[model samples]
Target: MNRREFVRWSGLGMMSLLLSGCGILGTSAGAAGEEVQKNSVSGGNKMKIVVINSSPHARDESTSIYLSDRFSAGAVSAGHQVFTFDGANEETHPCRGCDICHMNGPCVFSDAIENKLMPELLSADMIVLVTPLYYYGMSAQLKTVIDRFYSRTGMLHGKKSMLIATAYDSADWTMTALSEHYATLVRYMDWVDVGQVLGIGCGSRSLVEKSSFGEQAYNIGANL
Candidate 1:
């Protein structure tokens, strides 16, 4: 089947069923995912959304996850199929400068990149990046994961993309670089622009929880 057709079929609940079974989440995230599955809306203009979250903190402690939880709940309530890629918990390493993937079939690293990440990315209709600003940029682990996309650049084209970011530096300038980076990736992938929730001043879990950014995130998903 064609990509559009496949995504349409996925909206029929096949992909929703796989969301919880994919083993991409830690225990806490996994339990929450079960709720998303249970509340899924059936037979509409649904989508397969892959959330790439790159936070080093544990599932319980991470502010990034907090925002993602809000976004996922909103998306599920709107009937989209959401699958989160817990980048920190997996074994995805930085792309070694082997330069082999360009001339070879795939990269040498065969852990999460091969086993989990690429599969979902290939099938996803939308890609959401949930990240904490690290020195005004994406986290190191997330950068590494993106680097590994070298092998499948062609396959990843033409998807929709969104960003959910948080930073302790409340200055508006803090998100400038990260936003530019995300814009660059969107251009590179030829992705349709979706809304973003850039949570400025969300320095900690409690801060993110208390922030209206969560509601912004929810509205993004709900309106979609």
Candidate 2:
């Protein structure tokens, strides 16, 4: 579906879900019943997806933000629960190579990773990493999160992964290194590589606003 149509549909779906517990769905049992019905219809538990958006820009104009939003919309529409993290805004401590986490214990830092992200990572069925390309590689903020994953060793194994990268350069080569790195990381974690979406030539917010990358991102999430 096109971006506009997807957005409209998603909005309507969200409204329906939100109102399902408010007597709008003609159910007296409230939201709890709605959830059970949904799970029953699906015949299994809904997938839990964690999306880590590592773009430094806090505004919606960033290409990474746009793609991540679209992906989240699609995933929610597909009955999956999505937890998103703004890596740049989060209080994540850099991995100090203290080798403390390697001892099968938590990292020494008492930051967001230990208090919040580790639980999400361990419970997620799928993980999506969204970042802006920096010097033909993932952003340092995102790299920090990846590095911190060392603390979890086997916690993330066998999960599904997707990468969405945006770059200012028009050439596809600009994202090659980042893509390879993501692939290697997925392999090392024993996670399946679901897909990768690269947004190129997005030097200006206007270019990204006018591109089909958002629709592609939505489709990726929908199909996942």
Report lDDT (CA) for all predictions. Answer: 0.73, 0.73
Clashing residue pairs for model 2: none
How high a TM-score does candidate 1 get?
Answer: 0.78
Q: Give the residue spans of candidate 2 off by over 4 A.
A: 1-45
Per-residue alpha-carbon lDDT of model 1 for 1-224, expressed as tens digits?
A: 23344234324433323332231222122323445444432123578999999998987788888998888997798678998888877888787767566522367888887778888888998888889999999988788878877666667766667889999989869899998788667655656656667899999999988988888787667655
Count residue pairs with overlapping backbones in model 1.
0
Question: Which candidate comes out best when scored by TM-score?
Answer: 2
lDDT of 2 by residue, 1-224 (tens): 23243234334333433332232111122323345444432223578999998987865677888888988887687678999888888899888877756524488988887777878988998888999999999999999988887677556666777888888898748888998787667655666666777899876678887888887778656554
lDDT score, residue 55, model 1? Answer: 93
Candidate 1 residues lying further than 4 Å off, grouped into runs, are 1-44, 103-105
Q: Whole-model lDDT for model 2 versus the true structure?
A: 0.73
Candidate maximizing lDDT:
1
